[model samples]
Target: MFLIVKSLMLVLMILMVLILVLNLCSMKTFYDKEKNSPFECGFDPKSNSRTPFSLQFFLIAIIFLIFDVEIALLLPIIKTYNMDNITLIITSNFFIIILLLGLIHEWNQGALNWLK
Candidate 1:
């Protein structure tokens, strides 16, 4: 058993060294114009970085995050659900109702609209 364990450790060390050597041997030294450029979100990163951000997209993202957190908050109530617990049910229901009202308010305000 001792010999087998020692052999396994030796094999693992050899394999690790082999992998490191192979990776270093295959490393690319070539520089690339496109590959090195920053991520192009809405405007060119290589050019002017002072491009105007879309506020409409930002508003939609904020609304999405609000709903996302609302779902996160609501999920725990599902796991703790008990018909005998009347107040918990009432409280969760009230929470859902409030979320729905907020959603409706956002909808009425046209904040949910994607295209102007």
Candidate 2:
């Protein structure tokens, strides 16, 4: 057991030394000029940065995130379905219903309205 532990420690030390050498070999001079420069994309920073964003864009983004997270929550339900679990199916439906009710409430409250 002591021999095995010592061998493992030796292997780890050699790997660490090799990693340090490789990192030093790959190091580049990152100066302030390179760091502060706008990226090489043809986009002009002055004009695009001042433009006002549309509310419709934000609303769609929020809805997309909400639904995206809902899909994340559904992954477990899918696993449960594969395992033939009825309780998980019912629980998943309950979560979907709650999301739908919240969406309806937001719609009624004009939170989801773009033209208001």
Q: In candidate 1, how many Å is residue 93 off?
A: 1.0
Evaluated against the true structure, the overall lDDT of model 2 is 0.78
TM-score of each: 0.68, 0.49
Which ranges in model 1 have alpha carbons more than 4 Å from their true place? 1-18, 21-33, 80-83
Which residue pairs show collisions in model 1? none
Residues 80-112, model 2: lDDT tens digits:
565456776788889989889978987887767
In candidate 2, the residue pairs with backbone N, CA or C atoms under 3 Å apart (3 or more residues apart, or in different chains) clash, namely: none
lDDT of 1: 0.87
Cα shift from native, residue 9, model 1 (Å): 9.9
lDDT of 1 by residue, 1-116 (tens): 99999999999999999999998998565597766667787578668678788888999999999999998999898677765678788879999999999999999999988897
The local distance difference test score of each candidate is 0.87, 0.78
Q: Which ten residues in a row have the lowest lDDT in candidate 2?
A: 39-48
| Highest lDDT against the true fold, candidate | 1
The RMSD of every model to the true structure, in order and in angstroms, is 4.5, 6.7
